[model samples]
Target: MAEEVEARTLSRVAWRFIPFLILCYFVAYLDRVNVGFAKLTMDTDLGLSDTAFGFGAGVFFLAYFLFEVPSNIIMDKVGARRWIARIMLSWGIVSGSMAFIPEIASAIGLSAEHTFYLLRVLLGFAEAGFFPGIIFFLTLWFPASHRARIVGYFMAAIPLSSAIGSPVSAALLGLDGAWGFRGWRWLFIVEAFPSIVLGFVTFFYLTDRPADATWLDPQARAWLQRRLALEDRRREHVSPSSALASLADHRVLALSLVYFGAVACNYGISFWLPTIIKGFGLSIAMTGWVNAVPYVVGFFGMIWWGLRSDREGERTMHLAIALALAAIGVGGSAFLADPTTKMIALTIGAFGVFASLPIFWTLPTAFLAGSAVAPGIAAINSIGNLSGYFGPFVIGWIKDATGGFLWGLVTIAACAVVALAITLALGHDPHLERAPEAAE
Candidate 1:
């Protein structure tokens, strides 16, 4: 009876928090990737060359890298509720502001090139802290054992947002001139408003910790608190100041390398996939709808991997195998000349790349606990994001130079192979073998 009751209670709490996390990420991702959709129109309208578009796209990660660690540390000090709300509201306003950049440039008589560059830089700074902040926030609610599945579910927001945004952007692009705005401008305006509203909702609904939550019954609250205490007690103690030292450890460094490779492939595909598909002579509207299919496949793939990882109680093997599959899938997409074959390959690649995300997060949360967990997670993510800059820039350069995406996909495949080797080498780390109790 007690076990059943506990399960039911936890399920209710999970339902509440998980969806909010997913929604927060959904908006974050929409802001992140809407630029991809916008590129379909904005590049031409703003007279941005291929290099300029790629640079602007990649710039978001530069700001993301600079602010990631500091933001996580701030979230740690101020609590998730306020920090996240602030990030959302501020970024939402900036996201909406992107709609007016072309006008601002025209009004100021700046060259078209300079205006787009300025807007992209500002957008990057606004969105800097979101992903790492969410990762740090998850530690407060879930134990190491439960975190992979939760992270998997949370990470699913990326694909889900893409799934929804692709068609919505397609629809918005079709609405060109409805309100005296270009389709891309409407895309920016329409997508951004939801984030501001969701930010207010987050402020109202989210609590920093279970102990701070008054909505739960006393029994439920006490039960959650006790379980979290036991989990926290099981881990070794390290002060927040020493957190960066973990980066010097071989195990953490190896994991960061793997993360770097995975993100390279992940973001490379995300930023370029629509353009790759459109190269096959599809219309912009069709390209938008078709772009959604791979992410739809990815959504299911993430759930399958997440549940399987939770059941198996392991991460390295799952990540390694998935990354290897991604290497083949993406490589095949690039190498194959047939449009149909390329679509199939792209869908397979999407599934493999996204499926590995939850497992990637699990490795860190499992190994690093308490105060060390936030900074350590942020550091890994911050370093891994270096690929975001490299991925898009390299892909754009390859496409421009070779007149094909084949070399770009091949490069990402090689990165995946390296990630696989790193994952295999990871078993020797004492961190992976430690009991969950010890992680606390």
Candidate 2:
């Protein structure tokens, strides 16, 4: 039937963009979290104290928060092809420069710790625009009804990146004397170059919008454009002024709080998990290998939750459930005496944390539409990233003061509870009146 063929055709087009987005996010996540692996060795090699290392790690979020909204707005105006390519290339260069920090510091007669700090800050600035820009780009390509699952698929890159990066980082770290550089330094150098190549590839392969996609046949293009227009009309008209006005809405404020709480708990666990496991008496290589397990579990969890959300056309309940699971996991890990119990708790905790990500991203795009959607999503994301700064600092400070991870894990659990409270308060419905012109 012609109808069936059209359905299949649309499905192919819808999914075509996903793989590229996944690759982009995979590299971004790897670049962001690679520091975790680097820290295991770099701390001693660079003479950084626990506090100093935490500060350096936390500083990335400060830069990320500062530029997130501006970057999203720019992506809206300049389009994804140029902006994303620029972001990838710039950050790749900065990421690779991380390899030379020690040598540069020695050459300049600065302390290794100070140089490391400086490099981290620079890396943060370079990577500031990436995640939010990707979110903004997604709005341009996918319809609202379909955004959550696509976002989930794209977000799966997070765990997948971790899955691949864990073993790769372990191998790199073991390459201590390969080419006159420590394994940690080589990790930065080798991991960062791929993004640069991908950046150039993106410029050629990615189209900013359906209107700009020249590869589609005339019938296909016409069909897609019509669908998009109808979908847009389902939503209420958000004038440019009204788009900005959404910032003043009470719901937006509440959602921001929920986002902050969620991100705090997520980053807190991400930055500290390996260290916590190592504290349980595992060797560095063993810890790295073990780290992949949670990420693998998390990948499956994210897929299951994402598919469920798409099928049910729901968001809040799943997010609340995920947060509740995370709270229990963190709380149990903090209190349970058995090592096996703690590891089980951590695996469940990662599953919960990752599972919530797609839902968290879906809410903002669902609530805010049109020109306002980009800024609204960016604002939520920017505020949410502040948790990145707070989470790491809180965990590090608690660990330094308490001489263990218990208080820190408890603090993260408390944050998860706050996230749950906010989610319940926000309710489940998508608030925006769908623009009729939007693509279904």
TM-score of each: 0.93, 0.93
TM-score quality measure for candidate 2: 0.93
Per-residue lDDT over 1-440 for candidate 1, one digit per residue giving the tens place of the 0 to 100 score: 65665676578678989988898899888888788888888888888777777777887788788887788888889888888888888788888877888778889898777876676667666766778778777777665667678889999999999988888987888878987999989999999998899888878788888888788788878877776666555554532335677656566677778888888888888888888888889998888889999999999999899889877777778888889888888988887889888889988988889998998887776556666777788788888887887888788888888888889889978888898898897762333433344234
lDDT of each: 0.80, 0.79
Off by over 4 Å in 2: 1-6, 107-110, 237-243, 430-440
Q: What would you estimate as the lDDT of candidate 2?
A: 0.79
Q: What value does the lDDT take at residue 29 in candidate 1?
A: 88
- Which tens-of-lDDT digit does each residue in 42-79 have in candidate 2? 88888876777777777888888878777888888888
lDDT of the structure predicted as candidate 1 = 0.80
lDDT of 2 at 39: 83
